[model samples]
Target: MRHFLYICLFISITINSQESIDATLIDSSNLNADQIIDIDNFETLYFIKDHTIYKNHSNKKSINYSNYQLGEITTANVFNPLKINLFYKDFNTVVILDNRLAEIFKIDFNTIQPYKNITQVSTGFDNTLWIFNIDFQQLELYDYKTNTTRFSAVPVQSDVLDLESDYNYCWLLTKNYLYQYNYFGSMISKIENTGFTEISKSNGHLILKKDNILYFKHKKKEEIQPVNLPKLLINQFLLTNETLYIYDLEKLHKYQLKIK
Candidate 1:
């Protein structure tokens, strides 16, 4: 009798369903990797591993190129045109590339040693890139042409969660708090509790993630709406238009999000 009751309880729990949470098991495609990065509006998918950039496109075809090392790719700048930014450590350097993955120019930060630390970086406009420097808690503007860095006073309160940017302001997350920073790294406004795990921008709005869920916030809206995301790992998530990409150990899965 005891064994029968145990089996029944297991069956009941297995059959139980939760309506509020919708989940679908997505198959793992033959995407070889421990991760994916640089999902941007620019269309091409670029991921770094073992000193190479594995690229895929609209046709579902994929290929790899010997480009930058994973350790050297301090950050991947997907926003730039047909190029990715390479940042290397212990050298205080930045490298830019062309569409064919050719090296264009390099910014040697060793020359700009005044800054205590380069906390963050992203692709910027007019032959320049954005830099977040810990020297004086400032958001720094670095010009590739002049090979110089300028500091703008912004509130660099110790607990910055995540950062994203357009040509204008910097979007950030901190313990569920969201903030917008101008080019000078000054906070323009405080947004709602986005629960944003990571942030990116396109079409004048902020794309955010909360607990493996995607949310979209228009410029003027006070709140963000939950987006339809396919089945993904609890600890990792990635999203783009129409397709949602998921990552886990040695596997990359792709799913089409059903939008209403």
Candidate 2:
């Protein structure tokens, strides 16, 4: 009887451990773009086509921004819709765009004092930018208004694969680990990388992708749970607070994350 009870308990634990979160297909639409950059809270679509950034709104006419001289746009950050950040790595420049895709300001790292080779840039609070200074191998919160760095994190030895931030926290995904830092430049959490290629943040939770599979890491949980999604060819993906958007070259599918 003792052995039989132990066998039943083991089976119950295995069954519970194998259960995964479900993602229901809420909506889908045809998407034709070279890449899907982001979908804002207002349902505005931002994408890239032929080296140009395009913004498509439901109620407004589409507008695009392009600079052939900049070579190529390395990244487009729509964290602040009013102040979109376009990073041109080849020229070491950042172009700030308004809501209508109009260039409002430009920052050329080449012309800045104490030269910074910025490989990545994201929106920071109150007219600031979170930039990765390759020269120092550090992540610096730069005050573009004052032309100075407010604070910087410790040097990261590995190559940074992705950088995403909100108003209060910054997350960096390196080749070996994923790190989260607070606004005061203090390390919050560090999780060893397990082949994660991309990351997106929403409401303090982390959504990570390894190849084509998606994983979710809650701010309060240490375990990274796999998001059970229907089989689809994932070319690009975006994670919002409640929805997971996946693009498969021809169509964009929206899945509602049903976390229990």
List the candidates' TM-scores in order: 0.70, 0.92
lDDT string for model 2 (107-153, tens) is: 99999897899998998987889999989999999988789999988
Total backbone collisions for each predicted model:
0, 0
Model 1 over residues 137-179: C-alpha lDDT tens digits? 5556677787666546455565555656667766667654687
Candidate 1 deviant stretches above 4 angstroms: 1-28, 39-43, 58-70, 182-186, 192-195, 228-231, 234-244, 249-260
Return the number of clashes found in candidate 1. Answer: 0
